[model samples]
Target chain A: MGTKRTLEVELSTTGLSPDGKPQRVPLVVGGDGGAVALEAPPAMEPEFEGEHMLINIGPQHPATHGVLRLVLELDGETVVRCIPHVGYLHCGFEKIGEYRQYNQIVPWTDREDYLNSIGNNCAFALGAERIFGIEITERCKVLRVIAMELSRIASHLVWLGTTCIDIGAFTPFLWSFQERENIYNLLEGWVGARLTTSATRVGGMAADIPDKWLEGLQGFIRTFPKTIDECERMLTKNAIWVGRTVGLGVMSPVEAVNYGLSGPMVRASGVAYDVRKDFPYLDYETYDFDVPVGSAGDVYDRFLVRVEEMRQSIRILDQAVKRLPDGPVNVDDVRIILPPKSKATSEMESMIHHFKNVMEGPRPPAGECYVAVESPKGEKGYYMVSDGTSKPSRWRIRPPSFVNLSAIPKMVEGHLLSDVIAINASIDIVMGEIDR
Target chain B: MSPSFTIVHPGTGSNATPVTPKNVPVSGGPVSPTAEAVGAQFPGVISRTVVSRGETTIIVDGARVHDVILWLHDDAQQSYDYLSDVTAVEHRDLSLPLEVVWHLRSLRYRRFIRVKVLIAKGAPLEVPSVMDIYKGADWLERECYDMFGVKFAGHPDLRRILMWEQYKEGFPLRKDFPLRGRFSRSEQLKNALAANPEARYSMEELSIADAFEELPLDMRRRLSEGEKVGE
Candidate 1:
């Protein structure tokens, strides 16, 4: 183990004296739980009031989206450089996923992107299922699509409401939450959990949809367009919203793809790269919906892209609901999915099968697959490497927010301080996904 | 509704099959061609190529990974532009202890190709950083270093990104590392915080501690004692 020692070093961050001259200072760096004492290296220069000032934003700021910290180097009103410091909410999800069973990892995926739990579940389930070489029933596939689309709408509502609040609009927040709540009301009935709805199991859903759940969704989809229209009236052409966000956070098409930005972030850059469309999964190819694209990769373009995406999601939901079938929701595999309640109660073999499946878990074939779902955020990918055992050898989550958030510094380097908040919102990051 | 979309429910589980044409991924997709192209381009560099479960993974020599990737980026016909993700895997039983997996997507071809590098088992688990080819690899490479203790030779600002500045414990993602960490700094941190009221607050760390405490204590103790939980 390393021992504690005192080391005095050159000071760059210590401001000039009242007379305006360089001053040397000794800073002590230590352990036993205390603030980091720093003496800037000779290569580094301290920020002076007249020249530049260093500002720390969030580890707890509303605009940051979560426990994200940014060390912004500000030269007057313009940002000279922006360094984002994340991992404040790191829970070692990858490590934990390696230890859990295939079915057990579903709930953990839900927490990665809390707003789009079902979407995250799909990515993991599909990845695991691919390795297992199992194609779920047609009904199960349609249900998976329905759950994913609902998650897209719910996550987008939160993004829309919060981004409005971030850019100094209040009324839309109320309107957006109302729409989000209706989805929650339906999901809670179907999935049992409101926020972290581990909605899907490895083969199919944990439980079949409740009676009349589709009716609620049908009503919501019919009315959600009106809410979108109302939201558009409030801010779509409003001078304040346009002035703040229109030209802010511009990322060129090549830059967007180069930086590995996906979802609407890349779409706003005129690249229509949606996992649902490009890399179709879970019967997305069967559904007819357009991938919305924006020519200008700006903050305003991102907003427009999201709104258009919501409309597309509604269209998918309409088709999926219309085609909802009467069949087994969960795969009827005794080794994979649990036995039906009717079978379990009557048949001894069915009960034993249920007991074995629950106590142990599905031991998929030894292989690996990287399955991605076009989640609300972007391409939510789960790269799973499974040994010939119940537990996965490696479970890697390529969270869209984590990768998308990496491009923020480039987007905000020369931008004004106020625009940083608006730009950050347009990226639509969820810290849970980013930190995981 | 299209008649093709309606899958005939033949049976359940092992016997069940999609009535419609199976949603089997397109095989001769651009990935297979690119895999062939890479093998042909760098004959010695590529050791093995496995196209399984609709994903193409090409294993290359750890020594020449950077050269192969550079070729992929610069080569006009086989130009792989998007570096989707960079991750590493650990297998204690294997001769090569670590394998750094890089997923690259060629947007022009609309396909994904996985390139991997195997690092020999040693103290310095290191690889070449591809930050120059893909700017997004900056944080991802740092994250690999932080989690797996795999040092990237040319990574700038290679500090611990996820863990605290003062963290000195072993890399948590290693195969030998216990799920319940061997060291318990909870008591020490609690005492330190009590003594210094003005100490910085990390709700994240505290929540993590809370989660660790929820696991079965006896099992965790045995796990920390280097005992395997189960087969």
Candidate 2:
């Protein structure tokens, strides 16, 4: 067998520095078997070092995943600094929530983080329910748990597919999206909407799962893990995937917590701070599931963490389906829950209750509450303040993507320009949430 | 009724099993232990501690919120290492003071606390920025400033985040700002049309290369004359 020879090319160009000095980086090629490397001159010229080129990516580019614009300062192919600009998709969702009734605001939550719209609905309902001091039925609690877990899997699937596409793996993208479509089918069957499933009301869900919906969910639960296993078989040890992802954007445990990274982003840094476990809600404490933690907080670790989370979500869904209770989906409170449609037309009291519920809306006592949930992205929270009115005095969305994306400049600074895409994909940002 | 779940801070190496709170009161419950600890550490700093909806909100003086938060982060007993959110609340009642809220969490001990500073009506809507404490505050503080016009004093790069740099419609989340916006439809359109798209690239960004020199003389003069093109 012939010996393989490695070619090393160190090609550089000369340009004028900001101070108008001639800056030259001479090209040198290795003749012997050597690896390709970009090497700077031992006695580097100050003018050459000072020549930093600025490039803008997106606000329209595909690699950004959304309308996110990033202005990068590059020294050669390495990123010197990255300044992200968002809000191109800003629609003032929070500002609008202040004017709408609590129930009306649930639909708007769907538009912010569209991938996790059902999870957002649940989080907002939990916050509003806390303020209203309403205890949901046992059936409602288990159903919400099911809804949240299903949406978590769906959101993670989107993240998996889109991130695979970003990193140049097309096969996994198709397989993941195919499974995601299955979950969407189940959601559409339940809520009559897929992408924007405003499935939960303030005190309970909009409606319970229809007849035999559990069968469909059980089918998904039984088959989804095989798809995840197939994805893992394809990409877990693939050289290109590992080369592009591992150790590219490393964040320490302290840095992850300090920067307010949450969900997989924080857990990947070995922080074990899942809101479902640390601050349980919707009977999450009663469920048995493991919060996956990764030692190295890199792009690969984030990928592994998210894939494991999808599996864990399936586990929760399986348990929820088996333990499904039989009862009313909404709270029994007349002030909040609308009267039954069958009774509303027949009874005057039911008609009056329905009229007042729709016209004036149920007013919670004057107070404020912040409810945080373990969203697919991170700790998704909805903060609401009611000044003794049907509408909120202030409505704030503690968007996980917005906080997670803030750490991008720190992660991308010293890496190659191409790694920026990998780091960003790992962040799994939905710009609708960030700009809202 | 009080909250059924207690706010228990676990000891080192011991994990605490937290359950969902049932029957949480509308107001008043078991206050977070940090509230009292913070109140004790900073005697005159904490004005009041309100337990509402099973959450503890310690109202701190506007001037000392940074100090109190710093202590919470540094203290072993109250290791609120994670900053959950930085936002402001503007009430519909115009007479009431605007409130700056910080949601802090301790990953180690599994605790959460809300720190608030009330910026009174007619007073400067400025709060000491926690950007120094939490790097995540960079954009959150900027967004708060953009939406509520609340200034974060020590923030290094507090600028309009969700809004354009030249946005002059006043803060969108403020009580006085109209829902449809300040200007009429035609006027808003005209302003949007007349906006210099070139100015969208900030002066600092343009200075990165020779792009700054390539700008028109009039635009350059206007930018140099302090037209506010990013921080």
Candidate 3:
């Protein structure tokens, strides 16, 4: 009889199990019925002194999206465990808001999530309004939806474009920026600022949508889907794209909910819960766009969810433009909303209100309200507390980037080191918000 | 009397803070069983519950905080599945000097609540970690500790998050700390550069660039040779 022979096989699910769950049965052998140990073959990385080699990536690495740091423990090519170190971008946003007045804090909120500046402004405005019990006009509601949806499109375009480049495809970025520049032009036309538009105000907006911006939006909408098609043509069925991303960074539905993922993150995990439909703030219920949910919560599914989201955002913009209401954007109430330049020059009270409003800021009634909006990244909420003072006692922002980035270690563990880039990009973190 | 008068408290006058009614029934009711389950299951954990603006604010006993959070999570039908945000407030003006607040949301019940714990005067800035129950709370607890100098017992790794690893002096977010930081961050950066000469960072990807606007206190303050950092 031949000496009992032993053969080595790489049990894809053998030594390393995805999702960091312990593999109870490690003795999965090949055709030779010889019992095996949990150890890998010589080809695999040798465990020296019972330790894995550690490598640190980014407080400045380009692929990290922003100044995120990762201390990854590796067994050769496969990552045994991933430890994420954030706070490289912390700015004390919550602490700073305590000193600034209610309306004065809008610009700071814009800096929190730079991509979705308008959405951040809108969420803060909604929370501030509720705390002050201010009811905005119908036109104001329509305009907010328009601005937010446009932001959603622009933000998603950046994500779709940058993430493709992150996964090694370069052409999609230029095509992606084309549509984004058009949207930014519209934002510039409406709110004088583009990337950091403190577009919306507490009671209403800064100004009515300037002159012919709506016509520009209509032009963008008619031509935007072709860009989406351009992206899909480049990546959707491409073997290189699918092979690298599909079935990677899988987060099950239960895990996704427990992780507190919202927006595209939770949607990719098949959770149909959207702040717009579930909570229904800012006349979001009135808009006719469907929430795009995915079955498998992998990187590919996340990509699909975001692409589909851009389409849905277009639908929302289309509806909003058709149903655009014409009225005074800001409330006529001089207390919360600033008086017009015409009124300020003519009347002493208006002038006094303007000066006080600019200097001292709107002293909202002392109470607390947590307003959550469906920002492109996730559910961005601002929890404001007023001690009946002009400045807020606590201005806490619930940034989705911070929360969503927390789930990365679980997603990236047991995968190859190269997959870290794919997984990180798929999550779409903006460290500005995470650090804030 | 007008409905508007009823809404805004008369005492606040023209700058009336929006009032969502002084209080509503939250600690007890036939409505949502979250408060009921918490009260029945974990006695003495939840002390006071204030319902305002159609939202609930629960004042929890700090001692049994971990148990309270665990019970709130594992329970069926009324699980506060989402740990929305964890932060601290310096209520220096109020009798209680420091208060930590937790915002929790339940997808099942589709309701949200704000839970608070007042750190007793002279008590060490420490709170039990809720990391085991909600993994997402890991960074949040660290952030609270970093900004407010609050400590989380049983935290896997708790250190200065936004600030540098060797940073001393005091917490920046505390009201006592000056807007321009006590230490000269530029001098500190120079020392860091001298110490770790190989530490190269792109300004765009670097956190220190933002740290300037953040740590712009007393730009004139020079580092004393006697003053030590990471001793």
Candidate 4:
């Protein structure tokens, strides 16, 4: 009877049968009861062979933008793993802060993010204000906002110029620099120095904005956005530019958040995390501006976000100029900020105040505070730990470039080696801030 | 009225009650709950609690640094996820060679805390590494290691960051290290050559090249003749 056997099939839910239920069920073959053979699943194997290659891109390469070296593990041209080797330009700014007085450290902050010197100054001054527990005057706040916004425009111009040059667009560099030169001229008129102003003091500013300087700033604010538009018109719709940047180095919002990305990087990823809005300091709440955000977290989004941010800065600058009050720029608190040079020379009381302020310094109460500001690169924060002394017991900076640069590996991994340069330019990292 | 006034005592030994104001409040109005909580948890760990200028600081024992840091990071109440920086101050004359400081911040709480570890002068002075918890601490720890020579146990790579390649055997940031150039002219030249092989030409050859490059035809002949006379 053809062995007269019944084929069995297993039916299991919990990998076991209930009492009285058979472990295997009977199956019938075609026209007769019979056993059937089943085929086993195939073994799996790796599709590709060979080890990933390690490539050192830069400590001294043109695309790095600074003295940045990236150690990349490549599977052919595609990057597998990337490790950024920082400290090639370590300045030890925090350690230097310990030796210098509160006001003396302002110039050092300028050097931290040289492109956004005014923003750095604002962050440091805001931190000092928090520690000193002094309220800034209305005029001082407006002045600071105006200065910082102008500096933001300048910083974005540099980024655009350098970034364009990186992508082989050379004309924009000269065009962007021309406008930046105007902003620098205005800044120089007010602060006496172009790059490292050291203009903002703990309580307020070193000097009031000169009338001519204010006129120049107002004139520049009106014209800056038109220039930005011209820049955008040149590159925004260009097929080649879009092709190079649009879909490259795409990072999700969740990945950006987890990686501690901030500023344009986070904004480009559709996250509305702005220090100005979230933790408002130095009267940033009063400013009328929009925080530009993008859907796709790509190099192009980052570029667009920065470009839009420059327009927003110009808007803030215009508002700041309009609302700028005419009065004492600094607070009456002589203990925290310095007295005017004229007052010091003329009045005996002012001389005594100056002497006391200089001799004793601003004795911040024993406490720690972290004050962050929206720097052109990202959230530039100063973490000051006071010990009721003239000098901060511990001075730490949350440099945006440093934190944003950390996301390099995530951005560059799985991208081609050639695309790495474009990604680096998009981030706009300054090695001074990174290594500090 | 006279500038100076004399006072007479009723009793033979002058037992007078101190004149005090009734309206004055005492003890700076109930210490900050956060500061008190930190103090209570540590239990004799803190040497002093300072509350002035709206800032609160608790000085913790240096020996119990790792324990304190672990508590700060792990404890739900104090989740200091980010290590802002690690810096050190050198006091050569004091008993401790270095006072290592760790600044930590909690993004969730928007609070900051400082932990200091004092290390005496000597080799093998070790501080527990926080790189295991916060990866950001790696560079900061390396920086501390490089500047202060304070060893951080389990640091991936602790090496000098800012100083020159041949800046061996001395921590330049320390108060003791000379600020000015330490090497002689010949030593500087040798070090420069060692650092960059491309700059292999000697000063004499460089001078000759500069003379030929900068001088006019007539001036070059005169300079060569002068050099020959000097030789």
Candidate 5:
């Protein structure tokens, strides 16, 4: 009996039992030593059944998307519990914002959500303008709309590319990043910086779009969707992609709202809540676009919603380019908007205004305002409190990724270890925003 | 206002499509009607109602804020189902009270309201946690605690989130703390160099492997003395 058992029995770690014990498979040796018979694994090794294992995935790992560290407790390959540790990149942007002027904080905003720096700059500028009681010109509003949409496209592209790499696809990563580079070239032409483009001021944009910048934008708008189509063709129906993403990290509508999810994260759970549509800032309400929502609230649904959002953003960019009115890019107020460099060099009053604006900064009334925008990740908001000074008393960033990442423990329960990577990628977190 | 444009406000639902607000006054616009409703239902709970830059802010009694928030979340008409943020503000003036703010959004009605609690200087910097109402408050509350040293009484795990658990420097956001940090660069570097790599694994993780007992005695003593990894 012992010789037969030793010859016929083989253990395989393929799956887990309902009770969380590691399931095994046994291969029966051929009766006449000619063929092997598959049989149910025999239960043994009782001591090993209850011993859970602990594993750590990041802090320095590439799959985490950032410096996020996840400690998962496992029963065989099934995740029993997951603990996430963040803030390895904490630089205290909020603390720093308290010491800097409202306009000075724009660059810091660029650093927080580095992937969406221009969008953050627009958000901060909008919040500051509200506090300063300066309504921007129509042209500035249109430019900000363009800036935000372009930033959203860049950010969503990064999410798509990195998530593909995480889920064992390589081609889409290259294609998405190539398009992202085109966006960077456009940004560099406008702001002279790519990753941290501080292209916004309190009253208006830092500079108007250069000659033929619109042509570059038109080129991108015309050709960018093809890349999205190509990536979709590769992964949307791929069996391996579907198997890895579908039905993983599911959150019901009610649960998604309770978790304070926004952007594609909440929209994927069938909630039609969009800050642009609901809260309506930067004239987003006037633009015609659909808010993509998903029914399943799974990773695959999130991917679909994000892809659809890129198309919707293109629609918005098209409308903005067509309707962009001609006017002064900056407000007429000398208190906030600096004088033109050419005028500053010649006119004494303009030079004085420029000196004062740069040195003292614009002082907002003693008040507070909370301005929220539909960032690519979610509802990004800036809460500014002023005490009748150039510097803000308190500057708080309502980072969407931070709140969205909080739901990971609930999402990863009962999932396999490999699914954790997919779920984390689905969160679309930037450590700069989370740790700030 | 033109009849073609539908005004966005509470109780209007989907029939009233929101439009981008133009010329929002710096102060004194229409306040959120929920402020009065909250004030009427929870008498003496709201201390002050302020409408600044077109957003309504209600300062509630610190002890009763949890009840107000729970009611605001559970009520059908005032369903502020989303907890957008949880943050605290320390004023530059030393005499002012610390303000703990909660930003709530009602997706169905398209309304946003800010609820604030003022903790007087020298008073216990603590408030009841709303984690029960919004599970998303877990990290927000923890982050508020980590940055401001404000305690959320009922939070299941109110630990330092961004900063390490054993970080001895005082709350960085406190007005009194220097911008450069509490310690000099050399001292901070010395402390970082002295930290043991094995100590970074939290006791919760170590307990599963039963590896705590095998650690060096001094390290065990440090961990046992309430020094642990991040939350």
Candidate 6:
């Protein structure tokens, strides 16, 4: 390696310099293997030239769906260089988690990936459980499976609705949302919150599932397949949708793996690696469901994979509900989880346990573990290191969106600018999770 | 729960019996030598008293940070190939200024370890970028750079992320930085107005007006009256 040098250069707009005159100023451009200098050249005006035109999509555009902006360098309609500028909704979630207790972080997880709050809750809960070596009850696992599957379906519905809108199909958005509202109702009945479901606790669920809530979920499961069929009938073979997606932004299996792509992105590229199947966590191994993979590796393939996944999630939910045991939802270990509110007021030991757990938190054996689960977006992994403390000494989330979004430049390198929207929608990025 | 067990290496084609619960100890001693080296190489790097657990972390000095990281990654015996994540801890009140941590794992050995580098608040607060060995370090390094302002010397792109453009004044994740939202207008909007002063209405003003028009009549009146919009 050679010694690096820093350079300082000045950039000034041709206008008043606070004194109402065209004055030059200095700008710093630090780099290595370079020189530092400033020179006054002939007063020649600079014009935006060249075939490539710089276009800003938005920090507030309909297609972005959230505060996401993309600066595209386009040669005619073809994208030359694309840069995804994020952080319009940076809440510093991980930093916030540092201050909150282990259980308190559950609510924050919901907001990180609002579309799949249940899955987010599961990931965080499982990570914390692994750290503390807490064994969740079989009933808790079954309930988690049911909730996560429902969340998967709801997430896919939003993806379908918004993706259709992105591709100029309007009616499907409303239709999908109508069905999605039913699933949200089911979620609310159980979690007491629809979108931001802070449902899961460190050792188990925050509470047991009510019978009526389970009944409603069973009803939803029965009716959801037909709704998925209705969605497919509208968009699957539609000439416009087929034309827009069939062969656009294709990525090969090798490239997908190299880029660390997961979920629908890798499935669309013909790899059959789902964390649920490959690395079973939360009793997912007991459930029999297919990991739907695609062959085309195009935007259409991604769309098809998600559509099939919703059906598979329904299958898993059906099995989970049927096998859901009639027993305590939480483990018997009172050291990790809190006692019931009623017990805390009545029993002395329970009160002391709650106080101790809240004040000191569960001291996880000094250890480190990496737990990965299949979230709606992709493989969401939490790599946690604990130093025998209540809080994680180091908690690093390997967000699927961040990894999946990395492949965006590769996906759209040679494609047209318009195709970028299709590619972005296909990736299904939630910037909250990505920026966290 | 039962203590599940397996023999590490059984004699050729011979079946190994599972270790019985009666034979199992309440706790076991540290098993891996690599783990022991982790403690020996940097004695005081970790708190002296070691806990008997699956994972152990060693906090190294910022000056020897690059060497320790390289050893963890490239040492033939250790072979910690995968760089899982890199994040920083902002302890403004700690004796050491700040801590930058890296979690490394070896898929072959089925082992995981943590290496931390501590830096004080000063000019050139830099750590060597592990991006050369682990491609995954690219974003993790950038994130640490963006949030904690911990400079990774060889990182390809060291610009601020998760913050608005031209937001260079402070590292938001630092404990001292207030959690409350900033009240100042964006640099882009301010510069735009400064360039074209005749454009009297600010972007915020226009957005508010548009939002008001879009809302239902009852809601609009409530918002205008300063009642909570969601309520």
Off by over 4 Å in 4: A1-56, A71-75, A80-83, A250-255, A333-369, A385-394, B1-128, B150-231
Question: Per-residue alpha-carbon lDDT of model 4 for B119-217, expressed as tens digits?
Answer: 666645688877666665655666667666778887775655544334443664565654433577688568655544221222323343344444345
Candidate 2 residue lDDT tens string, B136-192: 899999999999999999999888988877787999998888888999999987876
**CA lDDT of every candidate:** 0.77, 0.84, 0.75, 0.69, 0.86, 0.69
Report model 4's chain A TM-score.
0.87
lDDT per residue (tens digit) for residues A1-436 in model 4? 0001112222211123567654533222232222322221111232587555556677888789788877676676777677666666766677678767788889899898888888789879988877766778889888888888888889889999999988888777998999999988988898899998899888899888887777888788888878888887668755446656755676666566545567898788776667676546666766778888877677877898999999898888888888888899888887776777999999998899899888777787656666668888877778776766888855778777776776787777667787788999999888888777
lDDT tens per residue, model 3, B1-231: 100001111112123222222222212333334666678887777887765455777778888877888777777756677788888887536565588888887766566777788887788988888888777887788778888899999998786666665656578777777666676889756755654312322222232223434322332132122322232
The residue pairs found clashing in candidate 3 are: A365-B17, A365-B18, A366-B17, B180-B217, B181-B217
* Per-residue alpha-carbon lDDT of candidate 6 for residues A216-282, written as tens digits (9 for 90 to 100): 8878888888988987876765545665675666666655654566788878777775767654676
- On lDDT, the stronger of 1 and 4 is 1
Per-residue alpha-carbon lDDT of model 2 for A1-436, expressed as tens digits?
1112122322333458779998844433323222432221121223455567878888888889899999887777778778888888889988888889999999999999999889889889999999899999999888888888988988888898989999998888999899989989999999999988888887888888899989998899889899999998767755457657766567778888889888899888777778998889999988999988877677877999999999889888888888988888888888999888999999999999999999999999999999999999999998999999999999999999999999999988777788899999999999989988
lDDT of 6 by residue, B1-231 (tens): 211112111112223321111211213545445657766766655443222234455667666666666776677667665565677875535454677777665433435566767676674668898877766577777778888778999888766666653454477676666555343558645743433222122232233334446544654675577643210
TM-score of 4: 0.71
Candidates 4 and 6 compared: the better one by TM-score is 6
Error of 2 at B16 (Å): 3.7
DockQ-superior candidate, 1 or 6: 1
Query: What TM-score would each prediction reach against the true structure?
Result: 0.82, 0.89, 0.82, 0.71, 0.89, 0.72
**Per-candidate interface DockQ score:** 0.16, 0.38, 0.14, 0.06, 0.37, 0.08
Error of 2 at A167 (Å): 1.2
Candidate 3 vs candidate 5: the TM-score winner is 5
- Specify the poorest-scoring 10-residue window by lDDT in model 3 chain A: A1-10
lDDT by residue (B1-231, candidate 5, tens digit) is 111111122334547778887888999989899999998999999999999999999999998999999999989889889999999999999899999999998877888999999999999999999999999999999999999999999999888998887778889999999999989999987876555332477767766655666555776788788775534
| Model 1 chain A poorest ten-residue lDDT run | A1-10
**Candidate 3: where is the Cα deviation over 4 Å?**
A1-51, B1-33, B92-94, B184-231
Top-down lDDT ranking? 5, 2, 1, 3, 6, 4
